[model samples]
Target: MSRRFSPSNLFLGSLFVLAAFSFDQLTKTIIADIVMQPPRVIVITGFLNIILSYNEGVSFGLFSEILRGRPEILVFTSSVIVAGLLVWMSIAGGRLEAAGLGLMAGGASGNIFDRMERGKVTDFIDFHLAEWHWPAFNLADVAIVVGALILVSGSFLSPQQDVIGK
Candidate 1:
């Protein structure tokens, strides 16, 4: 009965969460099990390539030395973040904000799943310019970043409507 618990909001949140989560997991599976086997690089373009790598820590391999190969810590941290996002989405106004929260939750969940199943996150998307390169990342990371951007931008753009409207 409450506005925060409206069926429409729940539907939109569920739709985006399911979609993002499924896509993230599917892409990871395909990259890890099929495309990257034999551990060789696959070039997609001059600027893009696939070379599988495992991340034992958070974004950009930060805290890899701090975690020291303990996946449980990452799993717990990700679970907490995802839980917060889910609660935030429940009360968030508008489909745009809800979708953003949903995507964040889904992506976080996918990475948490990875930490649990493989003891690390599987990253395969590689971007480079000749000798210059960026750290490898996966689909879940993309979803989380874009979702956070959308959520933040939507809040600033719509203010009350995006965060607390009826």
Candidate 2:
């Protein structure tokens, strides 16, 4: 088998993708359907709260107005991105890169599923301080961000040969 398709790399990549996707969907379902039936905010800590939100657009609600009635566009675009991420993961130079790409792919998959089923993405988990409140997001979003950080930090820590083989 080619190095890009090594058994270990494929296993690790698939594992992260499945795990991230499952966890993200489970959390979203529980939080949005079971816990927040009435759609009210629940305080979790000094800076955290659970509040349900349906985002009709991309990250941070950008272009929401323009995409208000066009969910197919978001779904199509996101699906393409997820496919690209999976392709990258398959050829990832190291475990960290594979895991990061898998996570991003999984998160994007979850959002795509949501958009297809509900015509919007379900978001919750709000962070705030004083009067300033960050936009609400979900577990999938967390996975994507953490995965990105892992990839970045790994790049800085690992030797050049580890990333691009000698």
Candidate 3:
């Protein structure tokens, strides 16, 4: 089948992207302005803690030294990635695929916005279990991870999406 955009799927994809971007940005803004003023950790649950922290690097704090004082590079790279994902989304075969890609693009754009406007990604949600603490992350990261999982799962589940074989 020729890959094409159904109007309904496109609309749904756009809605998911906009919603993700808005929620991610709003949470980060609130955390930066109101939650981090005094720099104290707030315990929301036994497994989760909210603390304001800045990530100058990509996931897992990678490339902090290389990207130091050079946020434009990060912003540019992220924009390129988001753009690529958007193209993939546009040519995607189904609403599910487009929705997943939209989520990823939105999340990347959110982090890119933070890097452009503030020079760093604001990470606040901290998760831990006993002595093991996962790296702090934000709503954007959540969207990206979940979106990736969806995309990967779709690839595996929908074999007929391939034209040559199933």
Candidate 4:
């Protein structure tokens, strides 16, 4: 059966995205303006710390240095991607799918906002094991990753399996 793109679903998806975006932006703003100067770090363990890090790159400062020095490319790319996602979300169906896209949109929007306004994204949560340290990340990154996982997992469930006990 074909799925119809309903207004209520669109609204719900948009609302979720907006909520996520707001939370992400607010946290980043707080960290960038109030927390980064002193750079407060809460040691969760020997390998994890909640430390404020202003990253200009996409993830874990991978392209941050390059993006930090050249903001135009990053800005343009993010804008296009975000716009494309929005368009896709507008027509996407399935409850989980809509929710996932909303999360991705919101997370991307939040980081994009930071890149545009603050010239970097504020990353606070850090994890490391042995010599390998993951890039510092924030709520938005978590949301995006979690949402993507949910979407991927959901894709594996057939309609019959979703409707009945599998």
- Report the Cα RMSD per candidate: 3.2, 3.4, 4.0, 3.2
Number of the top candidate by TM-score?
A: 2
RMSD of 1: 3.2
> Model 4, 38-89: lDDT tens per residue?
8777788999877877787776678665666676677788788878767766
Instruction: Give the per-residue lDDT of model 3 (tens digit) for 1-166.
Output: 3477567656766777898899999999899898789898999999999999899998978999899789999999889898888777777777677788888888988999999888999999999998798989999999999889888887775635632212
* TM-score: model 4 vs. ground truth: 0.84
Write down the lDDT of every candidate, Cα atoms only: 0.83, 0.84, 0.84, 0.74
Separately for all candidates shown, the number of backbone clashes (residues 3 or more apart, or on different chains) is 0, 0, 0, 2
| Top of the candidates by lDDT | 3
Question: What's the lDDT for residue 87 in model 1?
Answer: 81
State the weakest 10-residue window (summed lDDT) of model 3.
157-166
Off by over 4 Å in 4: 1-4, 35-37, 159-166
For model 1, residues 9-127, the per-residue Cα lDDT tens digits are: 66787777888889989998998898777789998999999898999989989988888579999999889988888887777667778888888888889889989999999899999
